[model samples]
Target: MTETALSFELPANLAVEKFIAKLSKKTVIELALQQYSLKTFYDSFDWRLYNANLICEFNQSKNGSSLSLISSLNGKVITSTELDDVPAFASEFKDNVMANKLAMLLEVRALLPLTTVDLQIYKINILNREQKTVARLMIEQYDQLKTRLSIQAIKGYDKAYIRLSALLQDEFSLKTAEKGLLIRALKRQGRKPNDYSSKLNLKLTPEMTAAEAVRVIYKTLLKTIKLNEQGTIEDIDSEFLHDFRVAVRKTRSALSQIKAIFPDEHNAYYKEYFAWLGTITGLTRDMDVYLLSFDDYKASLPESMREDLNPLHEFLLFKQAHAQKELANHLKSKKYLTTLHDWELYLKRFIEKEDLQKNTHISIKELADSRIWKVYQQVLNDGAAINEDSPAELLHDLRKTCKKLRYLMEFFQSLYPPEKIKTLIKALKGFQEVLGNFQDYEVQEISLKQFSEEMMQQGTPSNTFLAMGVLVQGLEERRGKARHDFTGRFNDFKVPLNQKVFKFLFAHKSKGE
Candidate 1:
């Protein structure tokens, strides 16, 4: 079904019947026109878009005020291609779809016109029939990045609402759904399986448990996307970069929350992915934050400084673009495809079919840790296997390991004292920072070189490019120093790691301050 949600009311000046008649027939529409009293906590008609899943919404009252939020259709929970056509439809109905009825309180039969068909995942309950063909929202387990987390307690809608809300919290199940898409991605890419995801699913073939399936789905991200750091998009077109940033943010958020749900032993795998995603996404994100904090930082500057700022922006943009391309390449690789496919197969196998019903209460850490650690050790070995020409790939793998460790510690941190875990966390943070700085600088340097060349070719002014060169020089030097320091610090890790410091910290962690 199309993932678009459109809700519009007729203007008070205009006839409600006329507006409803005009807008009721979408390319494929299902209508629920019913009066909804505002929740007591929200006395006003505070209607917000549910999630990123919202395509476009426009409302008009008989009065002359309206509201609308533009949307996109990436990773929409509802699998409908019609959603791709929503923007055009929105563009078509822009004028009459919204009402100018400006009332803080709206208490008519609020129409909810949706464009989707797959309603099996949704079960609506019939409270007193309000003549609305649509069932009252019994369950809502959806969240868009823009959507606020909320709880609604209707007198009779509690069961479905609670069930769906609970299901949404179990991300393991969501990831399994995503894993299906990943499988499609893999077949689209032409790759074979690594046997990890499928094997795990096979073990769970008896009956399906959304809870149990979650663990396996998480393991896939730990194995696949966690290997590379995120890519930035500042250097691209503004619109492209904006969407790119959003995608990166969502992916990182997904990775973080998914890892957070697993038992302690399995936590290591997620930690590594989180670490890597943070490292890669940091440079451009820092720039974005800087821009957000000091809007005039780049535009208001002395001549020399302006020159430097121009180049710096150029350099950062280049790095961002390069990072995105790198990530894209990584995602398209055989290794990634294998992981993605295997993950989906497992999801379909385990989640769709409940296997472990009898002994479902055991901690999954034992299973996750033993399995992931074995793979992680092999990753360390595989990284070492790369020749000098492939130092980058090797380094990527190393960062992956660190990410796994970070994921592990973070998940298990609940079991340990903050103080005990502090030292180890600090070190992990440092290691991630060092490599991150190096990567950003490398990208910056390359971009500067490109800008300088392009300027020479175009015979543009030199001051900005020259200033950028100077900036890169400073960053490059710092990066060199950081790398050297990181190597030394990497060696330093031997001390605590030898004593099983992380494990010890986790084992003895305090529950409270």
Candidate 2:
């Protein structure tokens, strides 16, 4: 059924019963109350649904459970499906319109429970002189104190809706509700949507000491680590572990690249710890990447050969689960806990010290300019050195250099002209994309071969082995293309416009500056 509804927030002090009693004086009012428990809001880790102005909720009562996908923009139920049970993953949804839509929106990501809320729904019918329903009102009281009022006009009753809206506004002081009840409740609990992201948002100043700047960066990374810890342990999604690994890598990069910012011994010690962290997570993340690409891998083969690939998929799944368990155990270990605690304490202690090391006293702008310029030139030289005849390892090494340069650019982006830095970063990213794909394809080829051996040992069928060979060939073709594209990508990055911007930002700085 198609209907238009307007949502508003009722003042906290207003009671639904009292409001209905007051409305009874103007017209006949009918009320129905619904108590919903185990009401959950679902979204991707990134809040894709909320960002798209969509609300997806699962409600369970004594009778059964229902899933509702509503469009917040129009307050309409886009689709509703009654399920025997709520599936943990979107792919597990039965064949239905709602499930299809959700699968498209959340392809590989699990639908994480953002928040749970208990709703007290009061459905009201406003009638006219003939006792015919003219309009409908839904007042949803969340737990207590918070209420959302929705007024929907019955078809052919626009005048009634206008009259009722005016009466509610004039008498009760209704205001347009900009946020959903789930969001409001989350706010009341001091949490908000999109509260975490993998990107760096730390604010660094030119006058801040190197120790303080390093502290700020590490603090942000530490928080990211902590934020993803629960999700990683629960195996909610691969991204949690992926993001955790990235944070650790960034922390390591900061320590090694931004030399002398912290004490030598501390930097060395934490670098080792972070290296351990990265190693422990490596197998799991690698398996996650392979498994996540399973669909594409299957499609790479002919239809006749696709069914044979199921065994490979099972093998990958088995390996992923095993690796994930190990990673979780490592995360929960005493050694891991002690490392994080010591690192945090180190940051706090060093940042508060009034005395500055020699390098820490320098202005961040000068330091950034010097280091970025050095890395930028290094990338150019390295990229220029590579040719069609160059070994694949050369390209791999150059990719690593590009990563360091990219991280430097991101860390000190605020110190330069905004547009200039943005343009340079964009160009660098395009170059890195080619290098990254090239490396990934290479890694995938090696991994598939390794898995084939393991599968054989485990008595995998010969058909599965043949399917894996086809997959390996497919990866090689992609890798070759990426290798071929490197020249064009490098040239694009080294174009005069980007070169000028990079030079203007980082080239003029000196050691003594």
Candidate 3:
């Protein structure tokens, strides 16, 4: 049997008795009431499930509690499980198809309770001449205020469903619901989906001055940093510290790369403070990365020896707790608080009466073109000079240069054609990935060696050190492989077509243009 359902918003003025009285004139109807139930909605902090058009809800009724995954588009149940409680992570759920799908989407992220609503349902039956049910209608009131009406079609009763729909629309003047209950409830609470992201999405124009554009970028970055600070202090997840560090790094890069937009002394003062901020937050974040990657480290060893790494995991966790405490203390210190306050106050001072830098009054387009072209050439020069015989420092330097270029392009992407800038960024990404992998593997091996020493000093097990040795060997091999792939990736990045596109999009323009 085919199934179709339609939902409409009930106007506030419509009384339940009056509506039932109006409906009885058109068809034979019977109304039944059910006790109110509570439904708690869940989603990731970033709304990963809701953004994908899926909803996870746990319903609590007199009978029992059940967890369900439903489609937001048609309001149909996709999968469900009868459970007494919801788990923090998807892997804790019973092993089944639904659990597997949830695990794939929510890797390393915890499920958070979004909101709860009281739902009271009224089930109405549309009867035929013989008193058999032909179609089903429901009036649902949420939190004792918001109401919705839904019509469900029974088998071989499509005509009844259509007739009921027309009567509700033509006579009652009820309009279709434009948004789902989750969205409407969130709106009422002054919250929104997809509100927080680490990406840079600035709306810049060519005519704005360089100083004005820089201020705009700085303000956005500052806001992102402040928003993530409490989460980082609480150690909610690794992503909080990861995003916080990214904002700090981006701020430092912008200050150094965007020359002549601010006074030299002012730039130096903030640069020093931000560098200190980066240092204090470094150890705990490093430990977070190591813990997050522990499974991969174990997988690199022989299956028989993988369990031997458990002791090393314990050692790392012990150190992480210490590092976390240190980091939290620093974040709560007066120095950290004062530095951010001073930075914001400095940014707010727009006194045009003060001294101006050389490039402060220039068009933003002019500054973006000149700075981006300069860095793009440096990337080409650095990549071309590296070879099999070159030192690792050269590759590391190239990686930092590539990062600066990527940030510059992102900051001023609005000045260039969207497609062209995106193409260049995409091509550059491949090159950056290889370099990043090479460096990551190298750093992991070195840190593991240091960790092994610390473990020995702390009287860790011998088998754990043996397991780490094997892991280091595997990482070295992978790093070598990534280093070998670097040349081909660089070659693809500097191909004639890519070079032509880069030049056309960002080449410096003459004054008259």
Candidate 4:
């Protein structure tokens, strides 16, 4: 049988030299010590690596630096690469197994430095009868505050490992450690792996009032916006702005959909401000999308003509930077700051019973069912009315309706049967994708035409305009395809099983109405 590695915690007052002397007396041991200038753990802001059952650590020494990807479950190194310095993105790593693995897991997200610690290592060799090393031990002290001992078994030397483990346990009365030094260090700083994510996962109960549940949802969304604000202003990556806007949209959708859950005055103030927030942030986000998809944009054209789009790329970067600066200024403005602060205070403050709205006092389940069912019926009605020649406005309106329904389902996901609600959501998502793509393509095509006129006014080369025209034509084709696919996608969503699940889960209660 293969022996898995083991780690043990030493008592706070135990002296390392004294422990080594005691161990040497029991068994012949060879020791080597080394110190690292620094050891840091890194992951995406969303904790992508940690969620994938992996952790990345970088170690700096006098000679150079090294990065290793380790399995969090067993504390085994999967791959290691030597680097001159730390990289901000996975694509910067040298071509190797680690680079390939990281690229797959961390698409566009930048690696963020999470925790750093001063590390010292004491390596010990367990010898067999002939004085040949059979097993290895690593004693690590982190930040001079805690120490850990790890036992790694050598293949064909399980007996030695078992004997050593038994001796440590029986003679020293050492207890096994539940986690590694890196994890413990993170805990010391009050941070946990997998603590931050962009997705919404709320825990709500049916017994709560509609007003209470909405408050909880808004609070979470507000936290998300605050968390991503700095990154967005710094333009770290497109996702920060993307996540921030999503939270804002969700807040707006809640205010609009869950009508009468808040007083009219409160709802009107927030809805107007959030709409303003969305408008100011839209241009930068649009440029981000275009730039992120530029590679694919190039691929869609002929090889010889692709270079013609280079000017467009440069133009986009300039525009994006200008828009980003404007957005940063807006975010720092007194109006923006005060609005968010007021919204936060409103969500957090106490409310008198007499001031609550009609829906506020009803159970959350009733509100969820009523809102979701009403939207679901509207979706079916609107989708069934579209045909080969329906105006684009109909699909656009349906898209917004579908989004509102999606938000409601997600907000109230916890109050229903997990698998059943998930099934309905899955169906809705497929339908939404067709509508979303259809709308995005149409919007992009229109924007490109306007951009070409602007470029012409600025004396951009005529060939760039030709290239853009080709891009616009391509977008129109894709948009047409999506519109064509809508019928089948909508039909799939309207299938008997999906209809059954939606009705079974949401349509049963109409008490809020």
**lDDT scores in order:** 0.40, 0.85, 0.86, 0.87
lDDT of 3 at 295: 92
- Residues 1-513 of candidate 4 have per-residue lDDT tens digits of 223479887788876667888999999898855555678898888989998888899988786789888888887788889887778777788857877899899988888889888877788988878988888888877655567888989898878899999988999888899876667778888988767799998999999988888888999999999999999998877888999999999999998888887788889989999999999999999999998889998999878789998888888999999999999999999999999998887887735444667887889999899889989999999999999899999999999999999999999999999999988889899999999999999888988888888888888888888888899999999999999999999999999888888888888877544
Q: TM-score for each prediction?
A: 0.36, 0.93, 0.92, 0.95
Q: Which lDDT tens digits does candidate 2 get at residues 110-219?
A: 78777788877778888888988899888777775468888988888999999888888887788978877777767877889878766788789888866677678889
- Alpha-carbon RMSD to native, per candidate: 17.4, 2.3, 2.6, 2.1
Q: Best candidate, TM-score-wise?
A: 4
Candidate structures ordered by TM-score, highest first = 4, 2, 3, 1
Tens-place lDDT per residue, model 3, 1-513, is 435479898898887667888999989998855556788888876677887789998888887888888888878777889888888788788948767878888776667788788887778889999998888888878864468888888888889999999999999999987777777777877887777776888878999998888888888899889988987888866777888899999999999999887789989989988898899989888888899899998888999999999988898899889998998899899999998998897888843544488888998888888788888999999999999989999999999999999999999998889999999999998899999999999998999999999889988879898999999999999999999999999999999999998888778472432
Candidate 4 structure, TM-score to reference: 0.95
C-alpha RMSD of candidate 1: 17.4
Q: Which segments of candidate 2 are over 4 A away from where they belong?
A: 1-5, 9-14, 32-38, 62-64, 129-131, 173-179, 510-513
Model 4 error, position 24 (Å): 2.0
Superposition error at 245 for model 2 (Å): 0.4
Candidate ordering by lDDT (highest first): 4, 3, 2, 1
